[model samples]
Target: MRRWLVLGALLVLVLLVLAPFALIVLNAVKTPQEYAGSGPLSWPSHVSLDGIRAFWTRVDFGRKLWNSAVISGAVAVLGVLFSLLNAYALGIGRIRGRHWVLAAFLLANLVPQEALIYPLYYLARQVDLYDTRLAIVIVFTAIQSAFGTFLLTGVLAEFPPELLDAAAIDGAGRLRTLVRVVAPVSRPTLGVLGTFFFVWTWNELFIPLIFLISNDRQTVPVALGVLQGDRMMDATATSASALLGIAPAVLFFLVFQRTLTRGVTAGALK
Candidate 1:
């Protein structure tokens, strides 16, 4: 009975979390007149493609999707690589002032983006990187790697001495050991971090909106967000926009969920 009650409670929580998304799916199919007649919760009288078509065409969603994917993917790869190198030095090399270094990374991570954007924008402009997707990738790689460095530092600091000893006996150098041993062992953790970096970069709005003024260069979130105030989009179209904005992220999460699960399980076992 207790187990059944726990399951029931979990089911209810899941429903609560999903309720808005379910409504979005419903609203996306609803005509504005039908929604006005029967209300948001009522069954749609008929499926309508108008909202979806309008939002998709207006936003040039395909271009936004490609831009988001490129930026997020680059950030994920660069962030993870940079984090791994930083953690390796701090965690394994026993570098001097390591704690202070880790502390710096932590403090950097603690600072909000709002506090740093002005300096970052200035730096971007000085380098002629302003208003570019490459700028977004570079900015977020640095930002995201700050947190990833702190995280990977802790995980790698606890790495097994026996594994290191075995690699040493095999005449492996630092790079070889990292590539052949430590990296493989830490694959799950890296996967989790990469997924996080990708998702966070994909959902970013404020910085991208500020940086990328050109409509053709805007990311998914920025494009959808800028459209929120337009009189051309009604409530149903707004819902459709929301769905379009979130669908890629949802699909990415589902694809990487196994990696996330493995990372959690490995952490638990350790």
Candidate 2:
């Protein structure tokens, strides 16, 4: 009876989570006339591709995809590398003032982007990095790395002393040990971090909207958002936009599903 109840509860939870996406899919296929007649939750009489087509063309979605890919991918790779190096120093090297450093990173993660936007905007103007993909990559890399450092440091702190001793016994220095021993041991965690950084950076709207002013450099989220004005927006198009914005992120999660699962479960065992 308990097992049956648990299964029933899990099924309910899954549906609750998927309800929003299901709504997007449902409404996205309906024509504007059908949508107006039947409302958002009602099934469409026939399928329509107008909203998706219009959105895709208006935003040059292919280029937006490429721009987002570049920025998110660069931030993911750079964030993981920075996180590993910082965690190695704080956790393995046991450097002086490590706690203070970790505290600072935690505080950085706590600081909302709303507060930093003005400063970042001013700095970008000064550095002449405004309206560039590089600016997005650099900013998100730092933000993601700060959180990654917090995660990785705790894991590394519990790392086995025997492994370090073995590496040192074989004449491996700190950097060598990190390269040869620590990183391999932490591969699952790193994959998890990279996947997270990629998706988080990909979904970012505010910073990219402010920094990437030019249509040519705009990301998928920003470009789609730009299209949603009184003239461009309609109920069907809004539904399509929600679906469009979430699709790539969902696809990325699916691709890295196994890695994320492994990382989440890595610490489960003794």
Candidate 3:
């Protein structure tokens, strides 16, 4: 009886989580009249692609998608690299001031982005990086790296001491051991962290709003914001565009969900 209750509860939870996405997708296939007339929960009477067509024609969605991909991919790669190096150093190197450094990073993470935006804006201007792809990439990487670094550090902390001793016995230098031994064992953690960076950077809105000046250069979230207006928005088209923007992240998670889950669990065990 208890097992049945648990299964039922899980099913309900899944439906609850999926409800909004179902609404979005269903609405995307409906005409504007159907969307505005019927409750979103109701199935469309007829399927149509008009919504998607309108969104594509109205918004430069292709360019925005590419911009978001480039920024998010760059952020994910750089964040993982920096995080791995930091984690390896703190977890394995036993460097001085490690605790203080970790504390500082955590504290900095606690500071809201709003508090630092003004300073970051000035700094970007000073360096002549404002309104540029590099600016977005740098800010995204730097902001996301703090938590990724912490996560990698914790995972590395669980590493078996025996492995390090074994590598040392092989006369492996610190860099070599990190590159060859630690990284291999830590790939799962890397994948998990990289996935996180990819999702967050792709969805990020604030920094891009502040720094991105050109509509052509704006990422998906910023571009979506531009799509909104005081006039009645094409409900179908907007939903379709949102679905498109979310597709990559959704696909990424679907593909790596297993590895990501395993890595996180393995790190916890270690």
Give per-model TM-scores: 0.98, 0.96, 0.94
Candidate 1 vs. true structure, TM-score: 0.98
The prediction achieving the highest lDDT against the true structure is 1
Compared with the true structure, what per-residue lDDT tens digits does model 3 show for residues 1-270?
A: 999999999999999999888878998888989878986777899889898878867778888888999999999999999988988889878689999989987987898989989999999999999999899899878878888877678778878899999999999999999998999988887888899899999888888989997978998888777777534567888788778777778998999899888876874663
* Candidate 1, lDDT over the whole model: 0.94
Clashing pairs for model 3 are none
lDDT, candidate 1, 62-82, per-residue tens: 999999999999999999999
lDDT of candidates 1 onward, in order: 0.94, 0.92, 0.86
State the number of backbone clashes in model 3.
Answer: 0
RMSD to the true structure for each prediction, in A, is 1.0, 1.4, 1.6
Query: By lDDT, is 1 or 3 better?
Result: 1
Predicted structure 3: lDDT: 0.86
Q: How many residue pairs clash in each candidate?
A: 0, 0, 0
In candidate 1, stretches whose alpha carbon ends up further than 4 angstroms from where it belongs are none
